[model samples]
Target chain A: MNAIEINNLVKIYKTGTRAVKGVNLTVAKGDFFALLGANGAGKTTIISILIGLVNKTSGSVKIFNYDIDRQFDQAKRIMGVVPQEFNFHMFEKVQDIVATQAGFYGIDRVTALTNSEEVLKKVGLWEKRSSIARTLSGGLKRRLMIARALVHKPEILILDEPTAGVDVQLRFGMWDYLRELNAGGVTILLTTHYLEEVQQMCRHAAILKEGEIVRLDSVKNLNKLIQQETYVITVRNMQPLDGIQSYAPVVIDEHTLEVNLNRDEQLNDLLIKLIQNGFAVTDVHPKEHRLERLFLSLL
Target chain B: MNSQWIAFQTLVRKEVARILRIWTQTLLPPLVTQTLYFIIFGKFIGSQVGPIHGISYMSFLVPGLVMMAVINSAYSNVVSSFFGAKFQRNIEEMLVAPMHEWVIVAGYICTGIMRGIVVGILVFLVSCFFTHPAIDHIGIVIMFIILTAAVFSLAGLINGIFAKNFDEVAMFQNFILVPLIYLGGIFYSILKLPVFWQNVSKLNPLLYMVNGFRFGFFGFCDVSVIFSAGLLIFLTLVLWQVNIWLLKNGIGIKN
Candidate 1:
């Protein structure tokens, strides 16, 4: 069964702002899907509508074969959301937030407490369970949100900008946990500004623009859409190199050069030429990530 | 337990915890204020003005003061709690939950009424050190207490739903609610007022609440107990319906 299906989803605000415009989307069961878009591109609106936080002007949404509006209880029962903002009570204790969320899903007190502890431990927050939520650092707070979202054991998890302000180490740690969760057959619908996150974790992706779905495909297939890729090369010499000017390299500095390569180009040939010309290459890497290139192209 | 039951219980538990957790703010102020009212108005001033209905002045004022504390606590508890939830945007948690609107309203009302009753009981206990006023009608007293709390709790919910900011909330309490309560016959009987002023005081619903509760205490009231109880019931039903409608429409929380 599909985890989520949205058709003709439209949300027009009171001021006539068309936040979402007849967007159709589907996430298969157990699929790790990414919804990518710029700010105000209707990413949050779509998630909000699905979760009943916002009323749709016209549309249909179903989760696990349950209609969102008609069978709201059933649909909402199997879904958990990590909103873009920290919506939990800040004055509340960490464990209470997670346990209360489980209780909201109808779990008994004993089961909710067990689930809360398990999820908190998994998120590395068990040691701080008694501490108030507002005292946690930004990275820990993000993990707390993840724990709260997962405490109920929903079949589908929606994470909207879950790691926005998190540092690199903590961000990657969360990525590992999410990967493990997805591998355990949990469907995850993620929306984030981190292109690297989508590139690493999402198998399928949909990019939205101006309240409309602009691109939807597997990550690998989307990467194939990029006809050219740019690479930044660093040389040992601090002076300009000789020869190989036909490739139209832009000198970033005395020792660095930026080169654009078509999909068919051989990087080894260019490296051999640089070596033959007595320019010792130190490093070479893509200027932009593959998903980032695609995302920018679609935008 | 069922999901609906669990959801309702959890909401109520959270609401109660929030109220009790801030005891200095929610529970203490009412007790202190009521104690002062008993000392200053019921004792010092009442000793000078004497009593009406052939009872001591301090004994006559206890029920009205207790009811005032109940109404204030019930109204403020729901307003501050719910509005705080909205201001912090944490109300979205319940909004996204798979619970009925009535469950949410009931959870809030239960907490508000709990605060009201707790404050009323504390205030009455404090009043005991000054005056030994016996209950004349325990049933009517309990009835009026619950009815008044329910009415004000629902009204507070409505005020919270429409309030956009802290100042707006304060405006409802300061300009509308406080004035109505003070003028609701807390200090003196409406019979002492002139004919026109007495009729004007009757227009305030709080007057009926105070008089009904006073009747419960002394069997003396300016208005009929039946009329006061009927008015309280009618307002409770109307405000409850209005709150349910506001929640169904997603007034201030949804855009």
Candidate 2:
């Protein structure tokens, strides 16, 4: 069953801004799906409409076969959302925030508190449960939101930039937790600016541009659309670039070179040529994420 | 046991917790203010004024002061709390939940009424320190208090829905609510007013509330008890419907 299905969705604000225009998309159950877009690309708008936060101008949205317009209560029962902004009460305690969210989903107090404890422990926030939300750091607050969203054990989790503004270490930690949830059969729909995250964790992605989906495919297939990749190579010995010029190698310093390799070009062939030319390669890595390159190219 | 019932209970629990958690802000001020009213209005001022309807002025002032506390507490609780939720964007929590719109409205309204009754009881106790007012009709007193609180609670929800900012929230209380309460015969009998002004005072819905509550205490009222109670019930239903309509349309809370 599809976790979410949106058809010909349109949203025009009262100011007459057409935020989302005739967008159709679906996220299959148990799929780790990424919705990629730049600012104002209607990513949040689409999510907002699905959650019934914002009224849709036209079209239909269904969650797990429950229509959002006619069966919102049923649809909302199986979906959890981590909004783009922090919306929980700042004055509330961490535990209260999560348990209170469960209550809104019609969970009893005892069960809600039990679920809150489990989710808080999973998110590493059990110790901070008694603290006021505003006292927590940004990363902990993000984790608290994740815990709140998961307290109801919804089948689908929708997160908007869940890792944005988090430190690299914490970002990786959240990714691991999300991966565990996805592996446990939770359908995850995420919107993020971190292209590296999408490349690492998302199986399929859809890139939205100007209120429309411009690309939708598996992550591996999307990576294939990149015609070229730039790599920063660190060498122990400087090479006189004579034979590797076809790769358009640019010398960054005495021991470092930047090179662009076409999709058909082999990095092994280029490295061998460099080795033959007296360059002892110490390290080679892409200067930018492959998905980021494709994403930028699409825009 | 039902999910919607559970949701409603949770909302009420959260609201009650908030009211108690901030008792210094929500519950204390009314107690202090009504104590001052009993001292100044009933004791000091009533000493100079003659009795109305053969009852001491201080005794007559008791019910009005208690009703005033109920009205203000009920109205302010929902307005400040709901608008605060909107301003902080935390209202989205319930907006995205599986509960019906009427559930949201009832949750807020129920809590508003709770605060009103709590504050009303406290003020009545404080009034006891000043004078022993008779409860002529206990049923009428309970009915009037609950119905009055419900009416204002609904009105407060409407105000909260339309309020765009904190200033707008205070604007309704100060400009509209305060004026209506003052003109509702809290201190003076509308019977003392000229025939024309008495008719104008009758138009103020709060006048009926105050008079109906006062009738419960002394068994005397400037307006017919039936008319006052009927007006209170009518206003409650009308305001309740208005609030439900606002929530259904997502007016002011959603875009």
Candidate 3:
């Protein structure tokens, strides 16, 4: 069964704004899926509908085969949601915040405490268990939300920009933790502005534009849709680029060069030509993230 | 236990913990306020007035003061706590949970009742320092306090549902609740009012609550004790149903 399935979802606000316009989507069980969209593209609205925060105007949503309209209790029991905004009591202690979330799922106090401890420690917040949530740094607060969502041990984890304000180091750590969870068979659904994260962690992705799905495919398949890519190459020794002018090479500095590879061209061919010209290339990387380039082009 | 029961218990526990955690705000104010009422109204004011219904004026004021505390505590507890949750958006934590709407309603109402009873007891204790009022019917005392608290708690939940800001939450208490409680015969007997005002005072639901509670202490009242009890029970049921309907409809909590 799919972890999440939506058919013709529609949400028209009372203010006469059509936020979501008949969006259809599905996330397979145990798959890491990314839902990418810009602000006002209805990503949060769709999520809110799934979690019962917003009443849908029309459509069907099923979580693990439990229809959200009819079997919402059963659906909610197996799903954990990390919303885009921080929605916890700031006055609460970190431990209590997580444990209280477990309690809301009907977990006993002893079991909730145990789960809280495990999830908090995993999120690097065990040491701050007694600190008031407002006292935590922004990154720690994000981790605290993650811990609270996980304390119930949900089978499906839905994270909406879970690493938005996190530093690079903490974001990478969170990615590793999320990868571990995915490997452990928890179906993961993510929405984020970080296209690099989509390329690194998501197996499948869908891009939403103005409340409609514009593209949906595997990450690798999506990357292939980009017909050309630009790379920044750092050379060990400066040399004349007359041999590589076919690739439109631009000299950035004494050691750096910018080059573009089209659909029929290969980086190996360009590197071989540069070497034959005594360019002595030492480092090479894409100028922009592959998925980011694809996303921009699609939008 | 069932999941609904567990969820209810958790919500109640969290609410109760919050009340105790902020005892200075939740539990202490009523005690201090009632103490001032006892000293000023019971001692200084009652000294100038003679007994009514063959009971001392101070004794006559005790039950009414206790009922007033119960009403205010129950109403404010749910209004402030629920509105605070809505304001901070943490109410979504429960909204997205697997529990039924009634579970959430019961959890909040139960905690409100608990605070009401606790504050009622404290005010009663403070009253004891000024006067030694006899309990004519302990059963009626317990029944009336709980019933009145339930009614107001349900009303408070409705207020919390419709309230958009802190000012709205306080508006009901300041403009509606205070006038009703004062006119409910807490300070004097409605029997002394002129015929038209006596009928008007009877229209106030709080009068029945205060008189019902007072009947428990003195075994005397301007209205039938059974009638007052029945009115309170009826109000409780009606308010309970209203609260359940509001929650199920997601009247103000959901988009």
TM-score of predicted chain B versus true chain B for each candidate:
0.98, 0.98, 0.99
Backbone collision tally, model 3: 0
After TM-score superposition, what is the CA distance of residue A42 in candidate 3 from its true location, in Å? 0.9
- Which residue pairs in candidate 1 collide? none
Question: DockQ (C-alpha) of model 2?
Answer: 0.88
Individual DockQ of the candidates?
0.79, 0.88, 0.82
The per-prediction tally of clashing pairs is 0, 0, 0
Stretch of 10 with least lDDT, candidate 2 chain A: A239-248
Tens-digit lDDT track for model 3 on B9-37?
Answer: 88998899889988999999999888889
Encode model 2's per-residue lDDT on B60-103: one tens digit a residue.
88899999999999999999999989988889889888988888
Model 2, position A5: C-alpha lDDT score: 92
**Residue A103 in model 1: lDDT:** 80
Query: Local error of candidate 1 at A256, Å?
Result: 2.1
| Candidate 1 error regions (>4 Å) | A238-243
**Cα lDDT of model 2 by residue, A1-299, tens digit:** 89989999999999999989899998999999999989999999998888878899899999999998899999998889998789899999999999999999999999999999999999999999999999999999999989999999999999999998999999999999999999999999999999999999999999999999999999999999989899999999786777888787899998889999999999999888988888889999999999998899888
The TM-score obtained by model 1 is 0.97
Choose 1 or 3, whichever is better by lDDT: 3
Candidate 3 chain B TM? 0.99
